[model samples]
Target chain A: MSDEIAILGAGMHPWGKWGHNFVQYGVAAAREALADAGVPWQDIKFVSGGATIRCGYPGFVAGATFAQALGWQGAEVNTSYAACASGSQALAAARNKILSGECDVALVVGADTTPKGFLAPAGGYRPEDPDWVRFYLGITNPTYFALYARRRIDLYGDTLEDFAAVKVKNSLVGSKNPRARYRKCFTAEDVAASAMVADPLRLMDICATSDGGAALIVSSLEYARKLGKPNAPRVAAISTVTPTFASGVLEMPDIATDSAAASGVEAHAYRSMIPLKAYEEAGIGPEDISLAEVYDLSTALELDWIEDLQLAPRGESAGLLRAGDTALGGKIPVNVSGGLACFGEAVPAQALSQICELTWQLRGEAGDRQVEGAQVGITANQGLFGHGSSVIVKK
Target chain B: MSAKPLAPAIEGWHTMQVKPHLIGSQCTECGTYFFPKQNDYCRNPHCNSTNFREVELSRTGKVWSYTNACYKPPAPFVAADPFVPYAIAGVQLETEQMVILGQVIEGLTVDDLKVGMPMELVLEALHETDDDIKVTWKWQPLTQ
Candidate 1:
């Protein structure tokens, strides 16, 4: 009678610039997930794919493309795209199907082959497009990350050392992760020595874009019980919410914040709002969370997410980092799969990759990166524009 | 070719004044402002009023935050040769109560500004097209 659905299995293709076709990675991860779930491809009643804009035409129609690539079995297909939140949205779609009595089992997959260096906007004098506008203004992706990272310094007295420490901690833990792309431990000096892309953020302070894939097999609780997965981890909540009006934080791809000049309307922090709904639906507070996976697009961003997740007090996340509370075996450890710090970003495949780490940790299969007795885990990410998501999983 | 005329980069986003103001549209009913001027509709969640009036945004604001770009951006950015790094600021306009982002005037860096510092808009050469110098609005520290 629970509203939660079962996470039957999780799998991933090692994240890196392998440079093969994205579909090949998707098939590999999908087959691995099916094998992990012990569910036949034909038994998958639904194919929910996180869409990739980089993979050419096939990426746009990802659900059917993946379905066809896996050998079509007449399964219902759905594809969801919300920039970086694509995987969470795809998982939300699968969860909806199961909870709505539409399907028993679903395969959720995402993969990408990204271009090296800065993800540039398309050409031409299109000033109307926000992406184009920002780029035209010399506001590259690191510009946004740097602004946020700089704010931490101005507001909280955070220092470059604290920022470097985040990279150091994530790199150390991520080194243990076989699936992580950058397993080499990064030191504060290494971070400081890197080229400065944006002030207060060195090249090491920012995450890289890499090619990778990840997948999950989710089923209705009833189907899980029938399959003898009664003890499997459950998808307790998924929140893919758009920002309320007057988004004050100046999200990426925008030239300005929503004007709060209108009387009686207020500017809202989009990142903080993403996880509140997930907590409400899961019937739990931050205290119940054992670990978290957040989008650390930049190292300082990990501190921002820790606060947004309410794991640490506002302006106190760096203190938590200093005290080791956010490291493995520490209180409410975050990004134990090394996070984007180690994995880099695979875009569509990245969010589900967080869920995969949670599934493994909850099942006590996380190897050395496991948080002891993890009962609940949360993942939070802010996609471009108005899209963002936070998902909660429980054992 | 050097005598080619200078023009607004994207056209009409800002004026050519020494103390320039970015052009935006305010929802007539809600008084909510939008940069690049949203003339089609209003975005105030409480009101669905479609009427909007083009208005000049506040000329000065406080720096909500700031940073600098150290690498050359890809076109259509049209960076200068040698790619001198330039500071960028997120200035919070008092009347609009919205933060607007723009590049800082040439030769300034993050070291030159801080959160809550006052800033004003100015016209600057964004990039030079073969046809003309494409200009854009940039933020300038009032202290400068």
Candidate 2:
């Protein structure tokens, strides 16, 4: 019951393409976080940064890079690269530092100035890399999303209308989010009229990549008391885990799977386990979650997360949508922050920014889209190459 | 790129190396199994244990889904040619309540694949690079 870390400050550099360096966005967000925390930059004891794939450098050392941008005060620094989960991982690293007494107060930042057009492979196309294979095979991210969407249709008997409903829900919420990249509400008819990005999936269904940054300042309970804000929002868990190799189901960004001839470990398919692990670590189950902020990389994915997160029975997510079980007034409000559908995917900054939304929702700061009487909130997101996942539970 | 026939990894084949076989996870909890084994941890939300054992997948499974690559794959994928059509599919395991994806072996055109058609897993020797023979796994419809 005593396991709690204070979320002293939360900040963002908005979510859009402004043609600025990623470090600038991160530093700006971090500075706002420090300011929000009512603490000086020199008072921060540690810095953790979520990584971004950068030119020349395989990974942008956000921790040290942002540290330098903010002027080094000799703070302990760390960097994490779990794709979209990078933000949560950065927050986790900072949390551990505070929990372990390695640091009393920490700064966590995530930012990305993504490339224009389709998120192509980083330069050279290596056939061995799944990311490259999917691209070269002409299997765009939308295509994989389509596969899952199609599967839902075939196996779960979902309809294209169900998919459109997802867009309608998230867009409605996103329209109210000032930090969201896409602020316009969309109707199911609008979704039906959109161009097809992949078979059965329209352009409106998929989330676009953008440039944005988000930051959070976390401190120990004692540190929060010293700052005069005795009651602060907390981060319960950060689940950035990988899939098991079993039957080696081919995940996105991968062509062939691990040969059953090799390691022989039973694969823990992510769709089923990833969210559960975070809930387990938080000592709460789906029934206890009051609200959720999930990675809706695609509209269909939001429905998938509904089942995967056990918000609804398997294959019943679409029905839940039709019945308004997941809407703002439903049993569990998901992605009340507008989600990726309206916010767009800002890659490295996505998952971390998701937690920022959770912080706001849990603290009853979400004005229009807030879940009524919200007590606990969760954030779910997955990144490429077994890189990211974050499930933050806050009350 | 030349059409080099895919060779099995078994002995007496044109290429060397044990056929790369598809692998997956078998649950001790409910007898459920999966390909691309869930090694990180047991996934069954109903089960709490992460204890999982690696098992060689069934050599044969039914075709659950199929698709064709109409364009050249990116670097690292062994494609020196452009617009070469290749067939791939999701194969359903008999024992595992899961489906695995792989390229259909050479000579087996997409026309030869059908959903629910029985297929067998095979190790396709990808390419010979000096001392190492890179191999991968594929699925082929069983001869009726």
Candidate 3:
């Protein structure tokens, strides 16, 4: 309804370890999306890729890879990598082109064949890279996440049950998703009994790495009408914003905090503000959002996302989960498509895939676990190295 | 040995944070801050002013969270052996209102740690060679 681009089609290769090349998955997803959109690949004026650093050389130039896989038409190609937010950045790139009238139809794709266990930085040692510094120092990813979980326990009085409940709520929804990697239901007991990956978080609490792909066909508002569906799912806003140093949020793969000794401004920490900004630009608030798909790399992280998304007040996300406010049948369902808790993380592709879930929800196409009467939806995720992202979609 | 500029200590060399802790830039007109210290300019889209200053963080804070590295980290991290258990701690500085993460000192395990425990940052040797020793700050329990 607002002046926004239209998501004519959304498609994803089943999210699992397919044991094939990332390009193959990306091509399959792209073809499905193009077919769904009723648009020919040759008509796509621009192509942007959410990169997969996991793929070595071919992953770096994902835009060209997908372009070549689809048969080279010389469309404008760009590949972006923002750790977890790569897919959202790709969506932003495509949307920007359409909004600026530089292109009418754009193809956006993100796919990855992730490594098993803890994701590590690319090979070699150079003290200069913070990621390498942290890893070399034996600072693993879960350790940082545990650090965040611990802080919540200290300052906010959160408990182990609160953390477990996040897995409970998400697992319930994840069981309904056929595309999910682990579709079994979980309980607080199950989470409590799971082996500790980090203090206060267990292996069940963490999302697994996966090999999967997701793609979308975005077009100008005028183009959507020309393609016959005047009322298609529209992308209201795409925000790929990062956090401010004043936030006091020390990110991972870094050895030190931003020196606050010089700047006296107490960091107004808002890593979750970007997504809300996108919602605001879309002229909607959390209450107005019928459902949501958020990054759930860890169960505790998902609760943090709930607070960060402003879906619930600070320190109250757990209560909302207990109240069934964020469950599939709740007033404002979250992760109705099982989120990353079920989907298994595909890295660069995950955030864009969240949008794909939103597109499905907003279009009233989500089977089994759909949020009833869904209208407005949002996808929220953060990428490492200062990438903050959110997207608002409305039917 | 004195600091011999160490093997580019962790690799893919270029920028490294040494004595001065990294901080980001913010727009006074519009509230926006960036870390890894945004050297380019203020990131707030609403305001374009580049009036920003550096801020040093607290050396001491409380442990917000922690986890041990049970698996050997992959490339770029120079390790002599396979994955050994190492602890990572997240510290929350009261003044900054942000949580920072780092490696716990060697020999420290989760059983020895608890949330809300006090921690202080200290620069310790990460790796050492004949000529240079790579030193980086890690979180250590105040009592330890």
Candidate order by decreasing lDDT = 1, 3, 2
- Candidate 3 interface RMSD after superposing interface residues: 4.7
Instruction: Tell me, per candidate, how large a share of the native contacts it keeps.
Output: 0.85, 0.10, 0.51
In terms of TM-score, how similar is model 2 to the real structure?
A: 0.79
Q: What is the TM-score of chain B alone in each candidate?
A: 0.94, 0.76, 0.70
TM-score-wise, the better of 1 and 2 is: 1
Report the number of clashing residue pairs per model: 0, 48, 33
Model 3 misplaced stretches (Cα beyond 4 Å): A263-266, B1-60, B75-86, B92-100, B105-116, B121-138
Question: Each candidate's iRMS in angstroms?
Answer: 0.9, 7.0, 4.7
Q: Write the per-residue lDDT of candidate 2 for residues A63-107, one digit (tens) a residue.
A: 888888899899989988877878888888888888888889999
Give per-residue CA lDDT, model 1, range B1-144, as digits (tens): 277788999888988877788999999998999997998878887989888998999989999888998889887688888888999999999999999999999988888999999999888888787789888889998855
Which of the two, 2 or 3, has more lDDT?
Answer: 3
A272: Cα error in model 3, Å: 2.6
In candidate 2, which residue ranges exceed 4 Å CA deviation?
Answer: A122-128, A245-248, A258-267, B1-60, B65-88, B93-143
Q: Per-residue lDDT of A200-302 in model 1, one digit per residue for the tens?
A: 8999999999999999999999999999999999999999877788887877988798989888986568788888889999999999999999999999999
Top lDDT hit: 1
Score residue B68 of candidate 1 by CA lDDT.
Answer: 93
lDDT of candidate 3 over B1-144, digit per residue (tens): 465765434332212444324343444544444343454565343446767655445567887667786655655455645545667787777655456777788889877778778987766666667777766557788754
